[model samples]
Target: MEPLNIQANQLILLRLPSQNIKVVKVEPGSIISLGKFGSFRADDIIGDPFGFTYEIDSGMKLSLVDNTIEFDEDDQMGAEQAMTGHKITATGMQQLTSEEIEALKSQGVSGAEIIAKVMEGHAAFEHKTEYSKEKYLKRKKQKFLQQFTPYAIGSTELIDIYLDKDPTRIYNLSPETLALALNMGNIRPGGNYLVVDETPGVLVAAILERIGGEGTITLVHENEHPNLDCLKYLVLSEEERERMIKTINWLELFHPEESEPVRTKTAEELEDLKPSHRRQYYRAKQREENHKEILKRADTCGFDALMVMTLLDLPTLIPQLLRFVGGSRPIVLYSEFKEVLVETTLALQKENRVLAPTIMETRVRKYQTLPGRIHPLMTSRGYGGYLLSALRVHPNRAVNAVGKIS
Candidate 1:
């Protein structure tokens, strides 16, 4: 087969077909050995001046346009090999399977690496099963996995980085994106914002990382719950965790009031105490100092917050949440799906405390193929996620008489 070239921002996904388990992501510039069958690096097949194609293990070329390779011999051999570990007779290119493709997309694997791996060894063989004859056509009909195709954003760019995390992964929004959102309307550096369905402290960490103002961020969850339970298993390095870890969980902050007045030096008399008495006075003050840190966790609730309520409950909860911040602040709501968001939005629109409420949706696709004609393709995964944004305006509030809209 013709030697392949690989490029950046792409990946290869491998799987255990029987178990539907994603085995690994093919790293760029690394050699993957299918054993005596052959070995190749994902980078070997990307960015070639020529388009994608396959050739025999002897280096005899075949173009996708020619389409002359027979699947019959290859298919039979692939089945035999899958069962008996027989080596492939020749090198040929094909696409990754649907499950493998989707797994790569979820991890934000790029397209370049995908194509190279396909050239290296796309199994053109049929998976053997008791229902093989009946399921054969059905399985063959599945071409590229549809969901793995990348979703379009507002515009295309020459280069973009993709990060794939698990659905429940703690996510910190990009500072640039947040900065743009904050500057959208009357949002300011220290103003409080509300989050729904966010991982514990992720959004807060993003905010704190950006505009390091003294203003506090309040966290809200249903049943007076803080979201720290979700953080117990995050796969972050210790260095990253140190900065991300803040005791935002409301349960961790609750303190009893009876512990107060642990100091007994009488206020007036305490002020006049000599340095020696003051030293002894502060010695007793250690307990109060410790308790202060504990109570501040809850009582010092930085930004006012509310619960995760149903669509019906939003009408009541949104207004109450607005009252806490009043009209001067901004409210951010994130929904996992759009229908509920539309319902929530309609309710908020009627309240008249909302100004410039917006619905924004973002999508990302990874592992794009650049140079191949019949590309070693994997469709991108995360297709239709959304974001809804709006400004909260109070009834009878003064209008900003003049400003250019973005």
Candidate 2:
């Protein structure tokens, strides 16, 4: 596993103080903005090791620093027990005026120094307990810190990036739901998979990561063009997509005979064309050959599993898609609404070709359970939705072999 470095003109995830992630391209000699968090020059981070926190200095230059903050628990906490931050804010909170803070910023003071200055103004600083002080310090850092971390875009961060940016874009498909679909589908490296992605490309991206570019993912889409636009953020190279991902629209998958590209000239006649003309001619011919191979793969040996994450009519779509899957293969479907997956399971149950069908919904929460200080994590929230699972099989009549004892 090679470490991915920060490169110019490539997308990287920028995590700011607000806990929001911005997918930014590091263009050389250009300014990268983080909205209210201010902007920084791209050159400051280019060619550096990725996933390291880069603190903004004087609003332009950046310095590498560890993002972790230590919260040393006091051994004698009983002697200093005090009320939380909310119980006492009468006159012990902030004393410095907003104008003074702006003045400090104009002087080009560092964020940590500015935070120290603000803490000096808090009259209740020494009276609070260790936990309360830690909470106050964290809030001050989030409010005044000009630090940001640039992370390499990969499968591990795509879920957090999308959920923070726009959950609705991916149909609210949480990390747990994505994992369930992959495991239930029996996805693995070097295995062939059939996918119908309507969560845009999040589901497809997850499959690509699990397969690790070892096998094929035949993506069946509903539009004239495949909507795997999210692959760019997961796997950066176009060549990787061309090699590992094969796409066929619904029309092409259902009726390959009618969707074939027509040839304008024979190979021998094409040879007489100029070099520039020959380049385009050969590219189209090769693409056509690849399309034929993909169709053949679907009609012959078949795929190992079939996975679906779509907003279309699954009750009608999934049954027809199951034909491309081999016998004993698993089929997993994801949907935010339980009723939709329940409807899909009911429709699959009626088709005797499927085995015991099941539908399930799940959720998760992050917690920090320390003695005398048990609570959910700061950013704790519930996630995940619903899934419908079943297995594909071939119908056969029972028979016994006739034999005579010797």
Best by lDDT: 2
- Overall local distance difference test of candidate 2: 0.75
By summed lDDT, which 10 consecutive residues of candidate 1 come out lowest? 150-159
Q: Over the full model, what C-alpha lDDT does candidate 1 score relative to the true structure?
A: 0.39
Candidate 2 residues 291-328, lDDT tens each? Answer: 78767776787788988888888888888887788889
lDDT string, candidate 1, 211-289, tens digits: 3443334444444444544222222244443322323332322324433465567878888999898877885575355
Cα lDDT for residue 250, model 1?
24
lDDT of each: 0.39, 0.75
Query: Which residue ranges in model 2 land beyond 4 Å of their true spot?
Result: 1-3, 70-94, 103-113, 116-120, 124-139, 260-264, 272-288, 368-374, 377-383, 399-406
